[model samples]
Target: MNEQPPGRRLGRGLAALIGDVNSPTPEPANQLAPDRTVPIELVSPNPRNPRRGFDEADLIDLAQSIQKHGVVQPVVVRPSPDQSGRYEIVAGERRWRAAQRAGLAELPVIVRDVDNRTALELAIIENVQRADLNPVEEARGYQQLIDEHGYSQADLGQVIGKSRSHVANTLRLLKLPDVVHDMLVSGTLSAGHARTLVTADNPAEVARRIAEDGLSVRQAEALAQTPAAERPSISRSAPAAKDADVLLLEKKLSDAIGMRVTIALKGNVGELKLVCRSLEPLDELCRRLGQG
Candidate 1:
């Protein structure tokens, strides 16, 4: 009588899916052997693959590796529903691209008969696990799954091995302007800095300053929090001077944790704050403090 949760419907987590794709050992008795060599021309990239850009240098490096050693891992594919004999790639497209550059006539493949939804899910899972998808691409992939397949944020977190908060935060990246999205795609701005700018009055201007001036994620957070009228045009503008010791300590703490650190002192009392761009650093900060 009760409704089942969507997260439970994600039959297996990323670990199991990854194992299915890249397990080094022989296939288990219960599972069908996905191993098969297919003509390179018969396999094509999925149009729906969430990853939009591949680094030329990284691909060339991979191609050189494939040329020397061959593709150790098989590319995952499924029979194209529209085309009679050709196959559509579900995962491992990067290796496929590299293999083409390596001039391989045939490729090793793991063929599965899955529908459109499962194909997208597999693609997203593989890319997300490998950290290959940029924040925008990653968020778009999540949105696609939700829009087309009725997946909840909790469902995505369960499938991808990320926290619900991580999923939520990543999705928020989509609300920024196109210029900000371009910054994310081009690697000019980090997800952390971009996250802080999402609610800024003029995210594009702040984002450009952050990139040009090389501000830390924490500094970007402070700038975003400040009203536009009060914010200095240049990041190097002078402000009320702090004690030399306090400035030194701030730099040291910021360097230690890779975030901005600030100290405020009042009559013999003080407050210390650490600015983190994302949950990962915050978790690390917590861990380090707990150990001490």
Candidate 2:
């Protein structure tokens, strides 16, 4: 058997929490005394969890340790009312899985009383606040807040105690290509590196370069500032603002049409555009032109 290296020795904190390492264990979420212990079966991994998967070798080592030590710590679980006779895991999936691999029939579990949304939000926030979440997971949380619960970016800031800009910035990471996202998750890239990428219309190409160049966050920011004359094909950009005459013509169109009209510049000459939503508005516009 390999001996524990000085730098890799089991920590006192882990020992104290689990009693021994072989047993299924739960890591403490909050400051508490006399940590409650229960079986691994009582807990479940989160469905919309951030962490993709644990390393197999590390897990195998953990399992071997479990065989020798038993779960030193307890796992946290909440009784499932919907699925009677089974409990949903609040946390400690790693220990639970390790115990299973170790062939432990039952692992220590601690029952918790967490509300659903509160539990989900807590799980997400736990990963996020630790900087453990990948960009994809972080974006999913921001989106969940916006789409599922109808919270605005400002509201998300209040809920998570983060700035709205932070929320927006994190959400922007979703725009990155899948390859870049994989890199971010695998620790080959950082979120700050990913942030600069989201602004690019062709983010995949930018992500590739960012990885290839081994660019620092500051360097990435500088790169992001560069004009896109030499980059790969991207969508046509928004048109530049129209000249004064075009703006005046838009105003004139609105006066003649009697509706909210926007005249956006097309090219050098620019162009006038008309918009009328309601039937009444359209009829009035026509009537004003003697074409009713």
Candidate 3:
């Protein structure tokens, strides 16, 4: 028999693995199935789970909902390899956390007999589908899968339902310094801003300036592209003061086009520049201008 390509082999069982985890609405039969309920203490989080940060406020809100209605969806788990009679959570860690907060003694779970690889895949799928993982977390997850399982970026894209470029761009975030990674995790910097800093001479310093000055992704990109020798002066010297009306117009234009806008005035003739971080936004701006 012929061997399947690496990407195809990696992507083979992803659809079935995602199954109900990707579903928005909970199936009635699966919810609170008596046989699926297990003691809360018996279920532990997967250490390899891609999602590291959980918003406390969001968790509190979920806990309140769980208290009112109980857990409507079952978390996915597998029999723990290290501990006998215990289950390791593959998905729904947030739900598990909220259930604990709601003082639940038992949790509904769908137990599957899966190996380490499949467990990680399920965790990533569930989090990515929900947009729960931050860029840093998502990138780290992809890196882990690649390092441990011989997965190519194309394989990851196919498995995660993302474009190959998207996977490649996300993986680029890992090249940033640890301080920059901290910024990303704390929401002090965005994926776009972080991406531009990947090849900068001093990413942490650039990231700090980007955050402190409230620079747009486009501005960050320009700053990252600037030479190290001139960066200090650029950081120190603020933009020329603008009239209130001009600033307001820039903001309006930025909001309207969903990109950064700058206006430079020289007498009656002036320049208005729209800064897009990616081709997609540029295309959208072109479409809008055409319609006008």
Give candidate 1 misplaced runs (Cα > 4 Å): 1-34, 233-292
Each prediction's Cα lDDT score?
Answer: 0.81, 0.62, 0.80
lDDT tens readout by residue for model 1, 1-292? 5635545544353334345323223244423444789999999999999999988876886787788788866788889889999999988899899899999999998787888877888888778876889999999999999999788898889777799999999999999999999999999999999999988999999999899988889899988988888996656554568999999999999999977899999779999997653223454566677669
What is the TM-score (0 to 1) of candidate 3?
0.74
Model 2, 1-292: lDDT tens digits are 5644211232332233223322222234432342455455655676756556566765786687779777654565567746776677655566678888998877667566666754565555555543445677788877875676566787666545579899999888887778888887787788888898766666666776777777778777666666667543333335576669867877887886666677655455544556443223453454455633
lDDT of 1 at 124: 86
Which of candidates 2 and 3 is the stronger one according to TM-score? 3
Best by lDDT: 1
State every prediction's TM-score relative to the real structure: 0.74, 0.58, 0.74
Misplaced by over 4 Å in model 2 are 1-43, 64-69, 151-165, 231-292
lDDT comparing candidate 2 with the true structure: 0.62
Error of 3 at 139 (Å): 0.7
Q: Which candidate, 2 or 3, would have the higher lDDT against the true structure? A: 3
At residue 106, what lDDT does model 1 achieve? 96
